[model samples]
Target: MRPISTDLDQALALLQAGELVGIPTETVYGLAADASRPDAVAKIFAMKGRPADHPVIVHIAGRQQLADWAQDIPDAAWKLADAFWPGSLTLILRRKPHVPDAVTGGQDTVGLRAPAHPLTHALLERFGGGLAAPSANQFGHVSPTTAGHVYNEFGDALGLILDGGPCTVGVESTIVGLTDAHPTLLRPGGIPAEAIEAVLGVKLIHHEKPTTAKLRVSGLLDSHYAPRTPLLVGPLAALEAEAYQRFEAGQRVALLHHSQMLQAVCGAECHAMPLNAESYARALYATLREHDGDRFDVLLLEQPPQTAAWLAVNDRVKRAASGWLA
Candidate 1:
């Protein structure tokens, strides 16, 4: 396999020619294509095996380009953009007629954001248009947090992957829907929901269940961000019992926990996770991706605390887990 390139000129040329380039964002690496070119954007869905109706977020340089892709943007949308633009927040607003149905999932609304990663920002600036990008991984799998992760997903099939190092935020952007009368939290991510609420000066209408959400958005599916191996999430005691049973039965079990493994379950590989939410979020996907596949028959994760700080981590963990133990 050829090494991933850091050449912005090569990335720009590829994107301009309506080809897919794996670009890095602070949140995660994205499979990007020129948003204005429907043919270019369609390649994103095709490569990821993403559903045609699922919308992809268009990454712009900043809020100044908002009008180019969306229309009727509300004051609240502007406020949130002011606070979080060039960071990790995605705003859903009425789409400009020129915006392709493929990008908007045939909906009137479009998802837009200005990613904070310097390399991708420069790429977007030089490209001088929105880049329709989704997590550079196979559909419904763990998101890529580094250029290597992106390479692992699509090998030489992807020509250029701008190596921007590992993602700092390590999760998708927080998606807020402003098309409704009230600002709604479509997805919780790098930015906390409370922070957005503070900026808007109103509590966001939190949509807990992605399945029931009227408008489609990225990372909201019930079984998304999952790994090939079966993952079970539950209380530590419950997981330990199950891990012990599995180990005794000659199964390869990986025990992931934030707390110390007081009782050493023989034959199971125990891995400690970051205790704090921020560090945990940064490490989540990479950890999952590393231990996934033939190494372990099953992964038993001790559930994190149910609190606001852990909201994004909990959301991803819950979706990734195949089941829960009592």
Candidate 2:
């Protein structure tokens, strides 16, 4: 956790030279590269060990700059932009042909957003164009919410780590794609599905699972946002008893729960994240990272409710615990 310099000059210099840096966003920290430069964007995939088929989102400064990257902006998209721009909403639109295919993973459409982070907005304003960036963690690892999480995952791969405190949203953007101007929800994220429906006055159709699914934004992989330590997910009561049993058996068990009761149940061994959606999303990655190391064995996440707000959290947790119980 070195005191990161928010100097735009040095950051843009590295970007211009086709290098990668860790950029902050309200949702999470992103591994950023020059979007227009194919070689630079390629480094992003290689560094993260991300699959080529998984496309990245382009970071734009504002709605006005959308023309540079996207060719077809739907009317519904305009509604979304006007309502949620400069926030955590990513729109998938037809690319303008100038954005590298490598950046879009050969998809005809590219994902674009104007992140609501001051440091990143300034960088995008000065650097120009867009940056093809994804969560600043190795593919399938827990997304970084803090600068230390980025440093832990990246090690020495990153040149600049812009410390913008902690991400406010703490999850990826709510991705909506307009293929035929029929807005589709490609991913559920920081913004809830119900909120978008309320705005559009119509429920967004989830992208057909078997087709037109991944042609939208990044982080839609079947498995992603994982942690190094194995996480056992279920009711907090079930997980709580199991954690204590494991701990008593001399196993280094880490407990991730929304309930404060379990915080003292494990004494100093248990870590409690935020109870609400916003704080929970913001604290998710860092909590995983904190428990991944030292004094922990199998991690147990006290499952959140199956409400609309918990959909994205459940998706991420299910992915992280993919191979653990199965």
- C-alpha lDDT values of all predictions: 0.93, 0.81
Per-residue error (Å), model 1, residue 52: 0.7
Best by TM-score: 1
- The sequence of per-residue lDDT tens digits that candidate 2 reaches over residues 1-326 is 46366778889899989898898999999999999988898898899888887788999999888888888677777788888889999988898977788878788988889999999999999998899889999888989988888888877668788888889888889888787655788887888888888888887888624256646367766667877777788787787778778877878877677776714656226677787877787778778887886556688887777787787777677767734321
Pick out the ten consecutive residues of candidate 2 with the lowest summed lDDT. 207-216
The alpha-carbon lDDT assigned to residue 320 of candidate 1 equals 98
* Clash pairs for candidate 1: none
- Over 188-226, each residue of candidate 1 has an lDDT whose tens digit, in order, gives 999999999899889988897756568889899889999
Per-prediction TM-score to the true structure, in the order listed: 0.98, 0.92
Off by over 4 Å in 1: 1-3
Candidate 2 lDDT (Cα, 0 to 1): 0.81
Residue runs of model 2 more than 4 Å from their true location after superposition: 1-3, 207-216, 260-268, 323-326
CA RMSD of each candidate after superposition: 0.9, 2.4
